[model samples]
Target: MSFTIGTREILAEPRPLPSKTVRYLVPVLSLIVGLMIGAVILLASGHDPIAAYKEVANRGFLGELPMIGTLVIATPLILTGLAAVVAFRMKIWNIGAEGQLIIGAVAASGVGLALGEHLPGWIVIVLSLLAGVAGGAFWAALAALPRAYLNTDEVISTLMLNFVALSIMNYLIFSSVSFWRDAERLTFPSGRFIADTAFLPRFWGRLHIGIFIAIGAAVLLWWILRSTKWGFEIEVTGDSGRAAAYAGIGVNRKIVSVLVVSGGLAGLAGGLEIGGVMHNLDPRALSLGVGFTGIVVAAVARLSPIGVILVAILVAGLNNSGVGLQTMGIPDDIVLLLEGIFFLCVVGGEWFLRNTIRIGVAGQPVGERSVP
Candidate 1:
């Protein structure tokens, strides 16, 4: 008996690497597609797409107060976006940012209400900001510990922690003798206003100093991620944990570090909400899912720090126009629908760009085969 041995070489056709232009262009195209889809839905719902869009655009972008209002609302979104980007970069999903943010506000408000009158303006401001960062970091570290030591699922822990944090905040507001509880305001469940010294300085009319802080944070984060050794470790950890481990990187430390930083950023956002805008720790003023919206913003920006800023502005603009849409007889639900469409389009486009499909057999050339 005789046997013949044959070797066949199989190769996958080279996929072209996407250029920077294409990377950006895809998201823009996705936005256009999402808008078109939204317009169709509007028309189907018996509303004039043109009028609805016009109203949204005019109020969101062109109107005097609306534009500024968008920026005002966008302040926290920027911070949360930064938080999401930082965690996402390290492959750590810190979904508890919302909770962390609340914790930060609670802590900062505690400090402000306690010593705000006696503290100097600059000192109060600094202390409040630091307190916010500390609060967020502490909350994030709670999740980080289990992730690092017990290898618990971070998604579950972080998400559950959000509810816990919210409950804690609510309990403090309603039950505890915290400084935020306002006895004079019987109609609303609100906290006492922090002293003027504790408030953040405004840049222009309604623009608070938080905007500058957000921008500076983004710039600093960008620098850290691109230039620092810790940044390199985070990138490597995200790319491949096994590889990072092999390279002597402390996986546990990196996880904890990223979560702490992410939480601190989110906490700062809460502090800004109280000190820069709200001026009090009100449970109702906490979040309308701004932290979650930040996840969308981070995704839309492809988790780039600079990109997150742009996406945050766009989302803020849309939210700002939501009221205008309502005034124009359009349903407020449309804004939510548009946001969902935008999120879907951006995520889908990114996924498509990163992966491709082939219809042929596995390990075989598309148009060639040998058979007996």
Candidate 2:
């Protein structure tokens, strides 16, 4: 029997137009658009957008002590952004960064209290930070173990763990006679003061050595992701789990290890907050949406560590406008609303950057493309 053969052709796929400039331009434009829309809304609501914006700029970036407060706010964001960047780069949704941070703060507070002037200042600081790192890793293990062994949804596990961490911290401060509680102040849920030796030395202003720590972390992480073998494995795993597995890159090991490191980074942020800023571990102080905001930071920065630092500073400045908004007869939550809008626009802009919407003919695809 003979078989008839027909000509076969591989169709051409419409490639995403590569514009090195648009990679930066689109995000900047998206931000401007978001701001314009927010301003319009503010005007419609009978508020002066210009005045409000001016006050915010005056209080934040353009004010006296120019970058100090902004840097202070950006510190935790930098580390948390790194945390999200690592997990996201590996396609691991380690959403429990907040919980890990909380636990880390708790652990650091414990170490400070235990050491309490009994040890050398240097030793206390080092041990407290290490305690925070260990605490975050330990907390992350709760989710990582389940994910690695049982193939559980890390999103749910990590998110659920956040509430657990918050509840546990709250209980220790308000409902129990835990070390975190301040016996001297019976009127509130504030935590006891950590030893002064545990404090990170301040710079000229309220800024502390934590800023340097965060900058160093960004530099170190940038190097690791760009030049290391493990980083390549993570990128591969994120791109294709099956391919990574075939290449002998143990998916489970990568998942667990990366998440642990991610959590540790966030925990370091928490430790810095307690040691450098708050001077004590309070659930309220730590739950300022820093972790969630870091997600936005990671996204806005395109997952680059150095970019994360810059974006984080800008975001921190924006958030610091809460008081200024309130002064301008706008609710403090206006910043949050504007943030939500900006995040949506940037995310949508990112999608548009990577994909094109074509108005094809009736028979052709409108949004579908096939690879050659």
Task: Identify the candidate with maximal TM-score.
Answer: 2
TM value for model 1? 0.90
Among all windows of 10 consecutive residues in model 2, the one with the lowest summed lDDT is 1-10
Candidate 2 per-residue lDDT over residues 62-148, each given as its tens digit: 864757888899999999999999999988988888898999999988898889689987789888988888888888889998998
TM-score to true structure, per model: 0.90, 0.91
TM-score of 2: 0.91
RMSD of each: 6.4, 6.6
Residue pair clashes in candidate 2: none
Instruction: Assess candidate 2 and give its lDDT.
Output: 0.85
6-42 per-residue lDDT for model 1 (tens digits): 4433333334576888777888898888989998999
For residue 249, model 1's alpha carbon misses the true position, in angstroms, by 1.4
